[model samples]
Target: MQGEWTGELVGPDVWVSCRELIPAGSVFAFLAEHRAALSPAETFADMYPSRNGRPSMPPQVMAAAVIL
Candidate 1:
């Protein structure tokens, strides 16, 4: 099962607030700004066939980690 970013919008935006901490125009910065737009759902849904077990890391996080 893949974990979704549930109920995150209601809380503090730690990622957005830390933009200055990441180097501008770098992969980290790019991902921090556009991870959701880059990592689409259809692109990775096939990897987790069953949505029953413990959820896996969010696709965007995995994508950013891979790029880094």
Candidate 2:
């Protein structure tokens, strides 16, 4: 599988870029901020899958991000 990616700050000058395989230490903020860069299906499945995969975010956290 192939996809687009963009890097963002995890700390001062430290960056994390999500791609076909996300780096293990990437934070939720990085994933959510760059959500649009990935395929819709991949984003949904990875970020909010119906069953086992990566853990889904709480509704409150998702809502907070959407509001920003």
Candidate 3:
């Protein structure tokens, strides 16, 4: 994958894609799993754009933000 790729850890050798987790609805379960791994203020920071007027959110967050 050259661009943004979403996947879940099913096993040491398996990275189940988000589509595999929930084949129907647009549920962002993967973010929920890694939210805790993110540092303090990271969640809010992820929600909002950059203060310097630069593009807000990381590439991954930007992609997911569209769903929200």
Candidate 4:
């Protein structure tokens, strides 16, 4: 069943952030900077179910995965 996006952890807190690894001028960095501004998650929020048995992947995460 479709569910709300809750998000998942890929690694520990000590792990280096993606922003640190990606160069500032790179496309990834640009996307990262504009990710929230663009509000992909909020834009697509209504596409997913709000209530269900299990939480779904975050809309922003899914959008990033598709873009990357």
Candidate 5:
């Protein structure tokens, strides 16, 4: 199953914001700014055919991590 990135970007536990630290135009900054639009999890839906297992980490997030 294709999982979604539903975690709050701004939450009570989040003391420091990523947008405040990631350097502009850097690869990390680019991924933080455009991860969802560039790598929608829906595109990898076919990779997980069964719907009875544990929820997978979002593909977009995985892709972003790989890039970083």
Candidate 6:
């Protein structure tokens, strides 16, 4: 089933969960910061269907997942 990307606040414990794995100088850190600033739900509202099935992942999340 398609799942919506609910931009819920990730808990503090999970913040930096991947910090050790990603290099400090990588572009991922920059993208992560920009991702937080964007409102993906509102930005891709029109692209989702209203009924009959589950919603698709938010566009921003999908983009980041693929690129980062």
Candidate of highest lDDT? 1
User: Residue-wise lDDT of candidate 2 within 1-68, one digit each (tens)?
Assistant: 22222333335532234343545556655655554553243444454435545544444334434643
Q: What local lDDT does model 3 show for residue 12? A: 52
Off by over 4 Å in 5: 9-21
Q: Clashes in model 4: which pairs?
A: none
Q: What is candidate 6's lDDT per residue for 1-68, written digit by digit as tens?
A: 33565557456523367767766667877767676465455666666656557656567767666766
TM-score of each: 0.58, 0.22, 0.20, 0.55, 0.63, 0.53
- Flag the better candidate by lDDT, 2 or 4: 4
Which parts of model 1 have CA positions greater than 4 angstroms off?
A: 7-15, 21-23
- The digit string of per-residue lDDT tens for model 1 on 1-68 reads 97775545565665778767888989777776786778866688888899698988778666865865
Clashing pairs for predicted structure model 1, backbone only:
none
Order by lDDT, highest first: 1, 5, 6, 4, 2, 3
lDDT of each: 0.74, 0.42, 0.42, 0.61, 0.71, 0.62
Candidate 4's C-alpha runs over 4 A off are 1-9, 12-21
Evaluate candidate 4 by giving its C-alpha RMSD to the native, one decimal.
Answer: 3.7
Query: Of models 5 and 6, which has the larger TM-score?
Result: 5
Looking at model 2, report the run of 10 residues with the lowest lDDT sum: 1-10
Stretches off by above 4 angstroms in model 2 are 1-49
Q: Score candidate 1 by TM-score against the native.
A: 0.58
User: Candidate 6 has what TM-score?
Assistant: 0.53
Winner by TM-score between candidate 5 and candidate 4: 5
lDDT of 4 by residue, 1-68 (tens): 24344445666422235557777788877776776566556677577645655667666766766776
Could you give me the TM-score of model 3 versus the true structure? 0.20
